[model samples]
Target: MSMVINKQLPLPVLLKEEYPLPPWAAQAKVRRDEEIRKIFTGESDKFIVLIGPCSADNEDAVCDYVSRLAKLGEQLSQRLMLIPRIYTNKPRTTGEGYKGMLHQPEPDKAPDLLAGITAIRKMHIRAIVETGLTAADEMLYPENRSYLDDLLSYEAVGARSVEDQQHRLTASSLDIPVGMKNPTSGDFSVMLNSVTAAQHPHNFIYRGNDVTTSGNPLAHVILRGGVDKYGACMPNYHYEDLVRLLEMYEKRPLENPAAIIDVNHSNSNKQHKEQIRIVSEVLHSRNYNPKLKKLIKGVMVESYLEEGCQTIGGEHIYGKSITDPCLGWEDTQRLLYKIAENC
Candidate 1:
């Protein structure tokens, strides 16, 4: 057998019991959820800024960043809705390297899933309780969602996972807003098909039981551009790309038609610093065609306390990213203020 059995980790339910969110924090999560869901429904005009480190590798750094966001949020409360991108489980194409906080809570330590579950749950609770700001996390592992479900306000399906059947089905069940990204292949129809599937009810086997989802009307599209067969990046965040996506929505009966542009990834060709210019261009596009604003809801940015990335090992910088490179804290702040101004 290729696989070896490690000790079984406790179920999500038991973990939740062990690290329960405070009553006040739970209330805060509900309020945050309501505010974010309205953005998809077009009930609010506030722009969303899903900004944070590429992967949340350290707890202290994450909390420190969120605390600053909390203060900034108070300043831009009327114009912007900031959601910390506290992504814990990162998808690896080759299935090697540091997976994320879920695989190893400590960057230099061995994998301890039990500790990981506890660490993530506690960190989310602390973010909510301390800052009163619920977060957005990628649903890299559908089953693991139950572990943080109570605290998360938004969920995203990455470009790689957008085409998977389980991802679509699971999105249908989530009551919160779910952003389905265009697949790595850059197929528009594939992404729209996912949104359609997620917006409709479905019956599927999940977690050892038969379940039926009520359908998620808030399910929408995310344009992170794409990669081609030749291993080159292809962008889809241009003026034409937004227009085409809007046209696609016009042809479908999907509910609350909206799209969020991911400024990094294939769109920026993985150039981290380009996120600043990308955000400006997207805002300009939204402003140029007032109609496009209906479809272009916001942009996702990868940023951290430091400007670039460092490999995981001994003597790591306190707040720099360990995976993909990211914009430093100073740049992140200035860009956000500019976004608020533009919006």
Candidate 2:
């Protein structure tokens, strides 16, 4: 007798059931939703500062940073909104290095995804509930979004994933505001295209099922710089670039005309110190340009309790980043005050 195949069998499982969000997470969701509404309504002119470690590899370090950030946020609440970057998942360029807390919660032990996810969620909840502050994170894996979606007030689509159809659909369905970064290769067209795609209703398959999105009007652009023809990074937040981008948005209105300037990444060429100067320069340039000033909504920066970064597997160092170098606490304070003064 010939053997028969069973086509009805489910695909082999890659992961187990997800852990439910803790009580703190539920409280955080309510708080974040209010802040998101204020941001989109233009009632809050405060520039959102999404500052934290390049990757949240240490739970204690992240919490310490947030505790300090919470105080600064209180002082600057009148002029700026502080959204701590509790980024638990990081996208790799060459797909190497530790992915993030979700992959390597225990530094040495083998990957315990369940433990990692739970640890990250706990950290995020603590930052929001204990510190009483909203948080921001880049959405990398689409399926993992729901785990932290309810707790986030702001979401970002990294340059590498901006043009992906799945991400655009994801953004459209998000209740929080989403910032789309320029393409990794330094193209504004792709960013604008992402905005268009994210702002319009879309019908697509989601998790083995069909779904339709009502479109996300809060989706906007984030000028994080692009690469030059000679392979050098170019900052797109300059007055000329900002003007051109605003003009492009005006001509082809998608979700919103506003944009956020990322002071780190290619914009600062990964130089943590230059982030402050670059942001100040952008502010000065915008002050001189009437139209540009109105379109620029906020700024994004990477900061941590301490300056610079250390290797993940190297000697355990407190406060330093394990992925990208960041502005130290002192510089972060100065930047926050400067932005408030400028406003």
Q: After superposition, how far is residue 290 of candidate 1 from its true place, in Å?
A: 2.0
Off by over 4 Å in 1: none
Candidate 2 local lDDT, residue 341: 88
Worst 10 residues of 1 by lDDT: 290-299
Model 1, residue 278: what's the lDDT?
90
For this target, which candidate reaches the highest TM-score against the unseen true structure?
A: 1
Off by over 4 Å in 2: 1-28
Q: Write the per-residue lDDT of candidate 2 for residues 98-193, one digit (tens) a residue.
A: 788887897555766667766777777777667877688888887677667656788899998998989999888887789999997878889989
What lDDT score is found at residue 84 in candidate 1? 95
Cα lDDT tens digits, model 1, 1-343, are 8998887888888988989998888888888899988888899999999989999999999999999989999999898999999999999999988888888998788988888888888888888888999999999999899899988988999988999999999999999999999999999999999999999999998887899999999999999989999999999999998998899899999899999999999999979999999999999999999779877888899999999999988788988999999999999889999999997
In model 2, how large is the Cα lDDT of residue 338?
Answer: 92
Query: What residue pairs clash in candidate 1, if any at all?
Result: none
